[model samples]
Target chain A: TQLLEQSPQFLSIQEGENLTVYCNSSSVFSSLQWYRQEPGEGPVLLVTVVTGGEVKKLKRLTFQFGDARKDSSLHITAAQTGDTGLYLCAGALLENAGNMLTFGGGTRLMVKP
Target chain B: DVKVTQSSRYLVKRTGEKVFLECVQDMDHENMFWYRQDPGLGLRLIYFSYDVKMKEKGDIPEGYSVSREKKERFSLILESASTNQTSMYLCASSFGGLHSPLHFGNGTRLTVT
Candidate 1:
């Protein structure tokens, strides 16, 4: 099975600090997505990168997909207290049906004020 | 606005009790998924349906079963709840496409004793 592994299972940083999380996989994927989940809520999609070397920006958050489609990264700049949550990366396998996604272990971040 | 609604936010049930987790999507999405989130295991897909009456098993479907009698509603059933089944259950829906982003509902936290 294709697995996505996320590094630094936990992170705590002061507000306004910058942080980056990594998601790596040995298998190449057709698409990759990043999600942020708040406490007591389900994860919400932050960005989706479909092409290799693709980069998308959402305000202070930046996401990049590896050129080989085997990895991705999420970087947050000037983090705020509201950014405390769990970050997850998911990949859509090239051989699977359109609806299946394999998710990473996740990175829990705490942005302290 | 896309909304995915989970029937309950929290639940506690004794062992051997039957449990049902309900999910509904108003966006008329063709893909519905059930996942369980644990501390070290971010999101493990239990089951997914691409259409009404169509179901597919995910990575961890041993103790779970799903039903999708209607297009917008999906149900996860635990025939006999066990302590090992305790986890945060999440429901997500997305349009039927290769790179469609998922829309999630506030998860249901279930505790089995």
Candidate 2:
């Protein structure tokens, strides 16, 4: 089974602080995706990285895919209360003749003002 | 904007009772997915459908089944609900592609007592 492990299961930081979440796996994936979910809502896609060593930025959030395609990271430059949520990483695997996403446990971030 | 709608936001059921979760997408997406989220397990795929009347088991599919009779609607069924099955169920849909972004519903929090 393909498993993606996320570090720092829970994080609490003051607003404007910087934080980074990591997702690691031994198995290589074709692509990696980042998602954010609120307490009572489902996850929403933040970004998708397909190429090895790819980097994408969305405002204050920066995402990077490892060169080996087995890991990824999300870095927040200056965290805000609005960034408080569960951040998830998913790796794309080929299964049953289709692309399937295997998600990590996730990092719960709480940014206090 | 893409919108994925889940029929219920919360559900309560007794053990051994049959349960069904419904999902619909207005974008005519060909791919629909069902996932369960737990405190430390992020999201685990239960089932997915790539087209009408076609279903595929995901990594964690035991005790769960799915139906996709129409292009926009998918249903997840639990023949005998158990306490362990209680979770936040999320429904997602996306256009067919290698790296298409998934649009998700608010999610259904099911509690089987």
Candidate 3:
């Protein structure tokens, strides 16, 4: 079975700090997606990277897909209180399967003022 | 914006009771999914449908069943609710494609006692 492992299960940082969350997997994926989920709400898609070594930016967040399509990363620049939420990474194995996604354990971020 | 709507935000049920969770997507998406999220377990897909009346079991679908009678609506059913079934249930929809991002609802927090 394919599994995605996420690093730094929990993070607490002060405002204006920079942080990076990593998602790694042994199985290659056709695409990877990042999402941010706030308390009492479902996850919201942040970015989707389909190419190896691809990078996508959304305001203060930067998402990078691994060269082998087996990993991905999310970097937050100058994180603020509004950035406090759960970050999740999901891998889509579209080569041999449908558009189903396998998700990683989320990283909870707490940005304090 | 794509909108996915779940019928309930919270639900409480007794063991052995039958439960139903409803979801509707306004984007005319061809794919609908049901997932359960728990602390430290992230999100596990329970069932998915690629089109109307087409359902497939996901990673964890042992105690769960799904129905997609229409293109815009999907339902998740728990044949016999148990304590272990207590978790946050999320419904999502996506336009069928290789790299399409999923649009999610606010989720239903179900508690089986």
Candidate 4:
């Protein structure tokens, strides 16, 4: 079974603080996706990294996929109060598991002013 | 833009009562999934339908059943509500393919008391 584990289940930081959330797994994946969800809203896809050792940037957010495709990380720089939300990482396996994602426990971020 | 809509934003039911959760998608997606989101469990797929009248059991399909009568709508049924089932339920849709992205609904918070 493939399992994706996220570290620091909860994070609280002041405005302008930098933080990083990690997602680790022992099994290799074909692709990884990052999502941000706010209160009472569904998760919005931030980015999808398919290749190992891939890094994708979305403004103040940076996402990295492990070289072995077994892990991933999300980094936020100069985070604002608006950045507070639940961050989730999902992994997609190759084969019949196509389009199916296995999600992580998620990191709940709280940025206070 | 793809839009997934859940019939209810919140639902409260008594234990032993049957519950039905409905979802609809504006996009003609071939794959529709029902997932239960718990704080530590993340998003566990209960069931998924790839085509009309075709459904597959996911990793955690126990105590849950689903029906897909049409391509645009999917319904999840809980034979008997339980306190343990109180959580955010999410509906997502995506093209039935190898690497297509998924679109999600805002989610319905179901409380079983």
TM-score of each: 0.97, 0.96, 0.97, 0.97
lDDT of 4 at B17: 100
Worst 10 residues of 1 chain A by lDDT: A1-10
Worst 10 residues of 3 chain A by lDDT: A93-102
> Which tens-of-lDDT digit does each residue in A1-113 have in candidate 1?
32999988999999999999999999999999999999988899999999999999999999999999999999999999999999999999978767688999999999999
Candidate 2 local lDDT, residue B103: 90
Model 4, position A60, has a per-residue lDDT of: 97
Which 10 successive residues of model 4 chain A have the least lDDT summed? A91-100
Residue pairs whose backbone atoms clash in candidate 3: none
- In model 1, where do residues sit more than 4 Å from their true spots? none
**DockQ-superior candidate, 2 or 3:** 3
Q: Estimate, for each residue in B43-109, the C-alpha lDDT of model 2 and write its tens digit.
A: 8999999999999888789999998988999999999999999999999998978878889999999
Per-residue error for A22 in candidate 4, Å, reads 0.5
DockQ of each: 0.88, 0.83, 0.87, 0.78
- lDDT by residue (A1-113, candidate 4, tens digit) is 32999887999999999999999998888999998999999998999999999999999999999999999999999999999999999999654455789999999999999
Residue A34 lDDT in model 4?
91
Chain B TM-score for each model? 0.98, 0.98, 0.99, 0.97
Better of 1 and 2 by TM-score: 1
Runs off by more than 4 Å, candidate 4 = none
